[model samples]
Target: MSETQKLETQISDMRREKNARPFTLAIASGKGGTGKTTLATALAEAAGMGVTLRDCDVEEPNAHLFVQPHWSRHTEQNRPVPRIDAQRCSACGKCAELCQFNAIAVAGGRAMVFAELCHSCQGCRRICPEGAISDENMPMGSLDCGMQLKDPAAPINFISGKLAIGQVMAPPLIRAVKNVGAAEPLNILDCPPGTSCPMITAVRGSDFVILVTEPTPFGLNDLELAVETVRQLGLPFGVIINRADSGDSRVHDYCRTRGINIALEIPWKRSIAEAYSRGDSLCEKGAPAKPALPQLSATWPTTVSVPTAMLMPPICT
Candidate 1:
């Protein structure tokens, strides 16, 4: 067998073994408007039954618009914020001093807790010498459990997290959404944009990652940042160039130089864009993009394999 064939066999076997447990695939982008959601929903549809799609983009999750799963359960998620006990007396400013985020402050012989500033680390509660610090559950967001209700036998389990209107942090809520869907054979996490904590939290535990990017200058710039991020994370990942024919060849060159595979190149199509605007899935029947999506899903492990050497090396600008 050739080197490529041998590698393909090895990866295929590895994926089969890993499928016995939950196999998570996270779809992420360095910036927004990179067709991250478009590819994510397409892949999820192509995976067919028993696949769980977790929309971890808590701030502005829109995957539901495409799948349109019938939501069956709604849950309110909460984070533990430090609540100071005035009766415990002796403020002594210990809790405030221990808080790195300045979520707690000692004023007027009392301590005030800023729920918005709290990261839910519980550091202040742990360090309070006077035992004046306690935990209060602050509402972080909501989680909705739904499925492709149209077909009960072949349901696509859909779960999404939505951050509260004023909530500044999203990693905690993203973590909550990820905690579920462990029992499914395949889980696709649609991560938030950028290389911040929220995106990191979403993609951290995935078995494989698919970074989506366009070929424009902004896309190339952020894709470089995202490539660096997944490299730092030590995760196996590949790039999918959306609108592959629209921009310059710099993105292609970057992948070539790094020995990174451009797993798939989706050329721009006006019909696909029009269908997407109407909340239609790429893999749905009569959809303009249906044909190309199956080729992606059918390739699977062979398509996603990244060279071990490529994943380890420092990315160049």
Candidate 2:
């Protein structure tokens, strides 16, 4: 079989694995406004039963806006922040020296932990020789879980992570969101934009990554960086060009030269853009429905089947 066919077969096998870890697919973009969330929510809605949609864009999660999950459970998420016991500290600056993020600093016999800078790695606690460092859970964010609030019978479990205002740590919260809902057969992670730590954290365990981008120069530029990021992580990925009909073919050229597969292309349409502006999913009835999105589902393993109505035909691809 060709490499593409081989990859599809491998992904199919993963999806069919009984009682194993869920087959994860992360939808990401190199820059904002590339429609990553739109595509993600569409797939999640189309996948129907036995699927979990995780909006891992903790900093500014918007997938919830589209899925409208009626949150049955809300939980506050906290990360460990080092609390130094001054009485036990010798002012030797061990914690400061050991901390890579500069989260801890020692001076004048006082060690202060910068809660926002801490990555919750707990390295300071492990490195403290005098047992001066203790861990305190610092409120970082919140997670909400529920089924489709608008339609309880939609058969989708939605989980979203929202970083508390003024909280700089996002990877921790994203990881927390991912930790839940592993038992589901299929998972769709809507990762944060850009190839940063938060994005990497969300995309880490995904079986496949769908990189969404536009045909514009800005889109092509960031897409290259995103492609590099995913490639370095040694993950299988494909590109989805939004507004495919409007811009030049630089993105296409780049992908062709790199031997990258363009999985699907969503054309630019006034009706589609307007529907998206009103927060409508392409899989929904209100969106400019056309034919079934075979180009996308074709990339899926044969074992996995999305309903024809759910996989609405709105775009050329």
Candidate 3:
């Protein structure tokens, strides 16, 4: 057998032996630039426990910019992509006809397959009577996991994945990272921006979701979409208003009216941003916000409910 085949077998065996622990927390936002990563890393560090960080934002992963991890293992995340055998293909367009994703198309008496478009559903292979469709493992991305022993006195483990450029599917890589770090070590999943498939996959299995947002009009709009996404997934989540004082109070009002809890409000502060840009944990700097970290952590399990009405009047954008 080829080396790839051997590697595949080993990975399969490893997954079969894997048993994931619960209590995954997903940090997500309706959009980017909301300091989601900053809050995620801070919460993880301030939790001050053995936690595994999974940066699921494959499109533009930047968590490594802050919480650096010592190298442990980097493994390729691959998925089965269909390959058509020219000799066996009958040009009957059976494969193309069966593919719901439209990944396969026939023209000029031959069929072509688009790997990126394929969702690996295997419908084409199953429907093809000619047995012309074969599946091959295609490289998707890479997952890096390591221990964050930044201070010899303090130790933490982190796992992150970088999706290959042009790779549209990020859920697979996210799952790969999670699988590798499934020791149930207080997982903090820093999900990708947006309320789409990638975000859904990242937070689907989490125990709770921390929806990070700002106080601007755009922030409120995106926060609603994000809340809807998490609610549709039936996951309990709360809001963390980053840049709390930068914009209108619409986010607070909306959260209150919708019966969503505003778990934490990170005020708009230049020092906080500067510290983040410089790769320093706000909790480590003895920043004023540092003291509130413990309170935020303690509220996770008990404060699961949101208010049904707003006491303060809503502010116009």
Q: What lDDT does each candidate get?
A: 0.82, 0.81, 0.76
The digit string of per-residue lDDT tens for model 1 on 1-317 reads: 99999988886666566756777889998979888888888777777567889999999999999889988899999999988779984768878888888888888988888889888889888888878778899999999999885556657899999999989889889999999644687788899999989999999978778899998989989999999999899988888888888989999998899877776778788987888899887776798766666445334445444543222111111
Worst 10 residues of 1 by lDDT: 308-317
Q: Report the poorest 10 consecutive residues by lDDT, candidate 3.
A: 308-317
RMSD of each: 5.6, 5.2, 11.3
What ordering of candidates by TM-score runs from best to worst? 2, 1, 3
With a 3 Å backbone cut-off (N, CA, C), the pairs that clash in candidate 1 are none
**Candidate 1, lDDT over the whole model:** 0.82
Superposing every Cα of model 2 onto the true structure, what RMSD results? 5.2
Please provide TM-scores, in order, for all candidate models, with all chains considered together: 0.85, 0.87, 0.83
Across 108-194, the per-residue lDDT of candidate 2 in tens digits comes to 778988888899999989988899888899999999998884444547798999999999899999998998754677788999998
What ordering of candidates by lDDT runs from best to worst? Answer: 1, 2, 3
Backbone clashes for every candidate come to 0, 3, 1
**Clash pairs (backbone) in predicted model 2:** 70-149, 290-313, 291-313
Q: Write the per-residue lDDT of candidate 3 for residues 1-317, one digit (tens) a residue.
A: 99988867765554444323435678999988887898888866765555677888887888887888887788888977789888988889988888878899999887899999887777888888889888888888898887777655446678888989888877777777767764644678899889887888888877678899999988988989998998899887878888888889888889888877777778788878778778887676666567656656445444473221111111110
Candidate closer to the true structure by lDDT (higher is better), 1 or 3? 1
